[model samples]
Target: MTDTFLIGMLVLAAGLFAVGLFGVLARRAVLFQLLSLEVMLSGPSLAFVAAGARHGDPAGQGMFVLVLILAAAEVALGLALYLRMARTADVTDSDSIRDLRH
Candidate 1:
Protein backbone atom coordinates (compact mmCIF):
# COMPACT_ATOMS: atom_id res chain seq x y z
CA MET A 1 0.00 0.00 0.00
CA THR A 2 1.04 3.58 -0.62
CA ASP A 3 1.34 6.51 1.80
CA THR A 4 -2.02 7.70 0.52
CA PHE A 5 -3.70 4.61 1.92
CA LEU A 6 -2.05 5.10 5.29
CA ILE A 7 -3.07 8.73 5.33
CA GLY A 8 -6.60 7.74 4.44
CA MET A 9 -6.69 5.31 7.31
CA LEU A 10 -5.47 8.03 9.63
CA VAL A 11 -8.18 10.34 8.35
CA LEU A 12 -10.82 7.69 8.88
CA ALA A 13 -9.55 7.12 12.38
CA ALA A 14 -9.73 10.86 13.04
CA GLY A 15 -13.35 10.85 11.90
CA LEU A 16 -14.14 8.04 14.28
CA PHE A 17 -12.46 9.99 17.06
CA ALA A 18 -14.59 13.02 16.26
CA VAL A 19 -17.81 11.02 16.27
CA GLY A 20 -16.84 9.38 19.51
CA LEU A 21 -16.14 12.80 21.00
CA PHE A 22 -19.55 14.00 19.96
CA GLY A 23 -21.19 10.97 21.48
CA VAL A 24 -19.35 11.50 24.75
CA LEU A 25 -20.32 15.13 24.90
CA ALA A 26 -23.87 14.92 23.51
CA ARG A 27 -25.17 11.64 24.92
CA ARG A 28 -27.10 11.59 28.16
CA ALA A 29 -26.49 7.97 29.09
CA VAL A 30 -23.35 7.17 31.02
CA LEU A 31 -23.05 3.83 29.26
CA PHE A 32 -23.23 5.50 25.89
CA GLN A 33 -20.47 7.89 26.90
CA LEU A 34 -18.33 4.99 28.03
CA LEU A 35 -18.95 3.19 24.76
CA SER A 36 -17.97 6.31 22.86
CA LEU A 37 -14.82 6.65 24.94
CA GLU A 38 -13.88 3.10 24.03
CA VAL A 39 -14.43 3.83 20.38
CA MET A 40 -12.25 6.92 20.70
CA LEU A 41 -9.55 4.80 22.28
CA SER A 42 -9.79 2.17 19.57
CA GLY A 43 -9.58 4.70 16.78
CA PRO A 44 -6.10 5.75 17.78
CA SER A 45 -5.17 2.16 18.33
CA LEU A 46 -6.16 1.44 14.74
CA ALA A 47 -4.19 4.47 13.57
CA PHE A 48 -1.16 3.12 15.38
CA VAL A 49 -1.53 -0.20 13.63
CA ALA A 50 -1.77 1.52 10.27
CA ALA A 51 1.29 3.61 11.05
CA GLY A 52 3.20 0.52 12.11
CA ALA A 53 2.29 -1.12 8.82
CA ARG A 54 3.59 1.88 6.91
CA HIS A 55 6.85 2.16 8.83
CA GLY A 56 7.58 -1.59 9.03
CA ASP A 57 8.06 -1.29 12.82
CA PRO A 58 6.51 -3.74 15.25
CA ALA A 59 6.48 -1.17 18.08
CA GLY A 60 3.33 0.50 16.87
CA GLN A 61 1.57 -2.86 16.70
CA GLY A 62 2.80 -3.62 20.20
CA MET A 63 1.46 -0.28 21.41
CA PHE A 64 -1.85 -1.07 19.78
CA VAL A 65 -2.04 -4.36 21.65
CA LEU A 66 -1.22 -2.61 24.91
CA VAL A 67 -3.93 -0.03 24.28
CA LEU A 68 -6.45 -2.79 23.57
CA ILE A 69 -5.63 -4.37 26.88
CA LEU A 70 -5.94 -1.02 28.64
CA ALA A 71 -9.29 -0.34 26.99
CA ALA A 72 -10.55 -3.73 28.08
CA ALA A 73 -9.51 -3.06 31.65
CA GLU A 74 -11.15 0.35 31.53
CA VAL A 75 -14.43 -1.14 30.29
CA ALA A 76 -14.35 -3.79 32.95
CA LEU A 77 -13.85 -1.26 35.73
CA GLY A 78 -16.36 1.19 34.27
CA LEU A 79 -19.03 -1.51 33.91
CA ALA A 80 -18.50 -2.65 37.46
CA LEU A 81 -18.96 0.88 38.72
CA TYR A 82 -21.96 1.42 36.46
CA LEU A 83 -23.58 -1.74 37.70
CA ARG A 84 -23.07 -0.61 41.26
CA MET A 85 -24.61 2.76 40.50
CA ALA A 86 -27.51 1.17 38.66
CA ARG A 87 -28.20 -1.09 41.58
CA THR A 88 -28.37 1.84 43.96
CA ALA A 89 -30.03 4.35 41.65
CA ASP A 90 -32.82 3.97 39.13
CA VAL A 91 -31.19 6.36 36.69
CA THR A 92 -28.24 5.94 34.33
CA ASP A 93 -28.07 9.39 32.89
CA SER A 94 -24.66 10.97 33.06
CA ASP A 95 -26.07 14.29 34.20
CA SER A 96 -28.10 12.71 36.98
CA ILE A 97 -25.24 10.90 38.64
CA ARG A 98 -24.01 13.99 40.40
CA ASP A 99 -23.64 13.09 44.07
CA LEU A 100 -21.31 15.94 44.93
CA ARG A 101 -22.23 17.89 48.02
CA HIS A 102 -23.01 21.56 47.79
Candidate 2:
Protein backbone atom coordinates (compact mmCIF):
# COMPACT_ATOMS: atom_id res chain seq x y z
CA MET A 1 0.00 0.00 0.00
CA THR A 2 2.75 2.43 0.90
CA ASP A 3 4.63 1.55 -2.27
CA THR A 4 1.52 2.14 -4.34
CA PHE A 5 1.06 5.53 -2.72
CA LEU A 6 4.64 6.48 -3.51
CA ILE A 7 4.18 5.41 -7.12
CA GLY A 8 1.11 7.59 -7.40
CA MET A 9 2.97 10.52 -5.94
CA LEU A 10 5.76 10.03 -8.44
CA VAL A 11 3.26 9.98 -11.27
CA LEU A 12 1.76 13.20 -10.06
CA ALA A 13 5.18 14.73 -9.89
CA ALA A 14 5.92 13.66 -13.46
CA GLY A 15 2.70 15.22 -14.67
CA LEU A 16 3.55 18.49 -12.96
CA PHE A 17 7.00 18.42 -14.52
CA ALA A 18 5.56 17.84 -17.99
CA VAL A 19 3.09 20.67 -17.57
CA GLY A 20 5.81 22.98 -16.35
CA LEU A 21 8.06 22.12 -19.28
CA PHE A 22 5.21 22.73 -21.68
CA GLY A 23 4.57 26.11 -20.12
CA VAL A 24 8.21 27.09 -20.44
CA LEU A 25 8.28 26.06 -24.10
CA ALA A 26 4.88 27.29 -25.23
CA ARG A 27 4.36 30.45 -23.23
CA ARG A 28 5.52 33.77 -24.59
CA ALA A 29 5.39 35.90 -21.48
CA VAL A 30 8.25 36.08 -18.99
CA LEU A 31 5.95 35.84 -15.99
CA PHE A 32 4.30 32.71 -17.32
CA GLN A 33 7.67 31.14 -17.97
CA LEU A 34 8.77 31.86 -14.43
CA LEU A 35 5.59 30.39 -13.03
CA SER A 36 6.15 27.28 -15.11
CA LEU A 37 9.67 27.00 -13.82
CA GLU A 38 8.34 26.98 -10.29
CA VAL A 39 6.01 24.19 -11.23
CA MET A 40 8.95 22.27 -12.62
CA LEU A 41 10.76 22.72 -9.34
CA SER A 42 7.75 21.52 -7.41
CA GLY A 43 7.67 18.20 -9.27
CA PRO A 44 11.13 17.28 -8.15
CA SER A 45 10.48 18.47 -4.61
CA LEU A 46 7.49 16.18 -4.43
CA ALA A 47 9.56 13.29 -5.71
CA PHE A 48 12.26 13.94 -3.17
CA VAL A 49 9.80 13.93 -0.32
CA ALA A 50 8.14 10.77 -1.56
CA ALA A 51 11.41 8.93 -1.94
CA GLY A 52 12.56 10.00 1.48
CA ALA A 53 9.32 8.83 3.01
CA ARG A 54 9.58 5.52 1.21
CA HIS A 55 13.04 4.93 2.56
CA GLY A 56 12.19 6.36 6.00
CA ASP A 57 15.10 8.73 5.62
CA PRO A 58 15.10 12.35 6.77
CA ALA A 59 17.28 13.49 3.88
CA GLY A 60 14.37 13.73 1.46
CA GLN A 61 12.66 16.32 3.58
CA GLY A 62 15.95 18.11 4.05
CA MET A 63 16.48 18.16 0.29
CA PHE A 64 12.98 19.49 -0.21
CA VAL A 65 13.74 22.31 2.22
CA LEU A 66 16.93 23.07 0.34
CA VAL A 67 15.05 23.10 -2.93
CA LEU A 68 12.63 25.60 -1.41
CA ILE A 69 15.48 27.85 -0.39
CA LEU A 70 16.97 27.68 -3.86
CA ALA A 71 13.62 28.41 -5.43
CA ALA A 72 13.17 31.44 -3.23
CA ALA A 73 16.53 32.80 -4.23
CA GLU A 74 15.78 32.18 -7.88
CA VAL A 75 12.47 33.98 -7.57
CA ALA A 76 14.12 36.92 -5.88
CA LEU A 77 16.66 37.27 -8.67
CA GLY A 78 14.18 36.67 -11.46
CA LEU A 79 11.80 39.22 -10.03
CA ALA A 80 14.57 41.77 -9.69
CA LEU A 81 15.47 41.29 -13.35
CA TYR A 82 11.83 41.41 -14.35
CA LEU A 83 11.38 44.65 -12.50
CA ARG A 84 14.43 46.16 -14.16
CA MET A 85 13.25 45.12 -17.58
CA ALA A 86 9.80 46.50 -16.94
CA ARG A 87 11.22 49.79 -15.82
CA THR A 88 13.56 50.08 -18.78
CA ALA A 89 11.46 48.72 -21.61
CA ASP A 90 7.92 48.22 -20.29
CA VAL A 91 8.44 44.67 -21.52
CA THR A 92 6.93 41.40 -20.32
CA ASP A 93 7.49 39.03 -23.19
CA SER A 94 10.76 37.16 -23.46
CA ASP A 95 11.15 37.74 -27.16
CA SER A 96 11.43 41.47 -26.60
CA ILE A 97 14.27 40.89 -24.14
CA ARG A 98 16.60 39.83 -26.95
CA ASP A 99 18.55 43.09 -26.92
CA LEU A 100 20.31 42.17 -23.69
CA ARG A 101 23.73 43.61 -24.53
CA HIS A 102 22.95 47.16 -23.51
Candidate 3:
Protein backbone atom coordinates (compact mmCIF):
# COMPACT_ATOMS: atom_id res chain seq x y z
CA MET A 1 0.00 0.00 0.00
CA THR A 2 1.22 3.47 -0.89
CA ASP A 3 1.05 6.65 1.19
CA THR A 4 -1.41 8.19 -1.26
CA PHE A 5 -3.75 5.22 -0.95
CA LEU A 6 -3.63 5.43 2.85
CA ILE A 7 -4.36 9.14 2.74
CA GLY A 8 -7.26 8.60 0.40
CA MET A 9 -8.68 5.90 2.61
CA LEU A 10 -8.41 8.12 5.64
CA VAL A 11 -10.15 10.92 3.78
CA LEU A 12 -12.92 8.59 2.75
CA ALA A 13 -13.32 7.42 6.32
CA ALA A 14 -13.54 10.99 7.49
CA GLY A 15 -16.18 11.73 4.90
CA LEU A 16 -18.27 8.78 5.95
CA PHE A 17 -18.03 9.80 9.58
CA ALA A 18 -18.92 13.40 8.83
CA VAL A 19 -21.95 12.43 6.77
CA GLY A 20 -23.13 10.14 9.52
CA LEU A 21 -22.66 12.83 12.13
CA PHE A 22 -24.66 15.24 10.00
CA GLY A 23 -27.45 12.72 9.62
CA VAL A 24 -27.58 12.05 13.34
CA LEU A 25 -27.58 15.72 14.24
CA ALA A 26 -29.76 17.01 11.42
CA ARG A 27 -32.45 14.37 11.42
CA ARG A 28 -34.95 13.89 14.23
CA ALA A 29 -36.51 10.63 13.16
CA VAL A 30 -35.40 7.62 15.23
CA LEU A 31 -34.90 5.36 12.23
CA PHE A 32 -32.77 7.89 10.41
CA GLN A 33 -30.68 8.41 13.51
CA LEU A 34 -30.13 4.66 13.76
CA LEU A 35 -29.08 4.47 10.14
CA SER A 36 -26.76 7.40 10.63
CA LEU A 37 -25.25 5.76 13.67
CA GLU A 38 -24.46 2.73 11.55
CA VAL A 39 -22.76 4.96 9.01
CA MET A 40 -20.79 6.65 11.76
CA LEU A 41 -19.59 3.27 12.98
CA SER A 42 -18.54 2.31 9.46
CA GLY A 43 -16.11 5.22 9.26
CA PRO A 44 -13.90 3.86 11.98
CA SER A 45 -14.31 0.32 10.72
CA LEU A 46 -13.00 1.32 7.32
CA ALA A 47 -10.17 3.24 8.88
CA PHE A 48 -9.15 0.24 10.94
CA VAL A 49 -9.18 -2.01 7.91
CA ALA A 50 -7.21 0.45 5.84
CA ALA A 51 -4.64 1.06 8.51
CA GLY A 52 -4.29 -2.65 9.18
CA ALA A 53 -3.75 -3.30 5.51
CA ARG A 54 -1.21 -0.51 5.26
CA HIS A 55 0.82 -1.68 8.26
CA GLY A 56 0.51 -5.43 7.77
CA ASP A 57 -0.95 -5.81 11.26
CA PRO A 58 -3.81 -7.99 12.45
CA ALA A 59 -4.70 -5.72 15.38
CA GLY A 60 -6.59 -3.39 13.11
CA GLN A 61 -8.73 -6.21 11.84
CA GLY A 62 -9.36 -7.30 15.42
CA MET A 63 -10.50 -3.80 16.29
CA PHE A 64 -12.80 -3.82 13.30
CA VAL A 65 -14.40 -7.00 14.60
CA LEU A 66 -14.97 -5.39 17.94
CA VAL A 67 -16.56 -2.40 16.31
CA LEU A 68 -18.85 -4.68 14.37
CA ILE A 69 -19.94 -6.36 17.57
CA LEU A 70 -20.56 -3.01 19.18
CA ALA A 71 -22.57 -1.83 16.19
CA ALA A 72 -24.72 -4.94 16.27
CA ALA A 73 -25.42 -4.57 19.96
CA GLU A 74 -26.23 -0.91 19.55
CA VAL A 75 -28.68 -1.64 16.77
CA ALA A 76 -30.43 -4.28 18.80
CA LEU A 77 -30.77 -2.03 21.83
CA GLY A 78 -31.71 1.05 19.84
CA LEU A 79 -34.41 -0.75 17.93
CA ALA A 80 -35.86 -2.20 21.10
CA LEU A 81 -36.07 1.27 22.59
CA TYR A 82 -37.55 2.71 19.42
CA LEU A 83 -40.15 0.01 19.30
CA ARG A 84 -41.08 0.56 22.91
CA MET A 85 -41.30 4.28 22.44
CA ALA A 86 -43.39 3.87 19.33
CA ARG A 87 -45.87 1.64 21.13
CA THR A 88 -46.23 3.99 24.09
CA ALA A 89 -46.40 7.24 22.21
CA ASP A 90 -45.70 9.05 18.95
CA VAL A 91 -42.02 8.65 17.99
CA THR A 92 -41.66 10.95 15.06
CA ASP A 93 -39.39 13.40 16.89
CA SER A 94 -36.70 12.64 19.47
CA ASP A 95 -37.41 15.77 21.48
CA SER A 96 -40.87 14.53 22.33
CA ILE A 97 -39.44 11.54 24.13
CA ARG A 98 -37.29 13.57 26.47
CA ASP A 99 -39.14 12.12 29.38
CA LEU A 100 -39.53 8.38 29.06
CA ARG A 101 -41.71 8.20 32.14
CA HIS A 102 -45.36 7.73 31.32
Candidate maximizing lDDT: 3
Q: Which pairs in model 3 have colliding backbones?
A: none
Give residue 73's lDDT in candidate 1 (0 to 100): 95
lDDT by residue (tens digit), candidate 3, 1-102: 899999999999999999999999999999999999999999999999999999999999999999999999999999999998898786757878786556
Q: Cα deviation in Å at residue 79, candidate 3?
A: 0.4
Report the lDDT tens digits of candidate 1 across residue range 23-65: 9999999899999999889889989999999999999999999
Cα displacement (Å) at residue 72, model 2 = 0.2
TM-scores for every predicted model: 0.91, 0.91, 0.93
Of candidates 3 and 1, the better by TM-score: 3
Preferred candidate (lDDT higher): 1 or 3: 3
Ten consecutive residues with minimal summed lDDT in candidate 3? Answer: 92-101
Task: Report every candidate's CA lDDT.
Answer: 0.90, 0.93, 0.95
Model 1: per-residue Cα lDDT at residue 83: 90
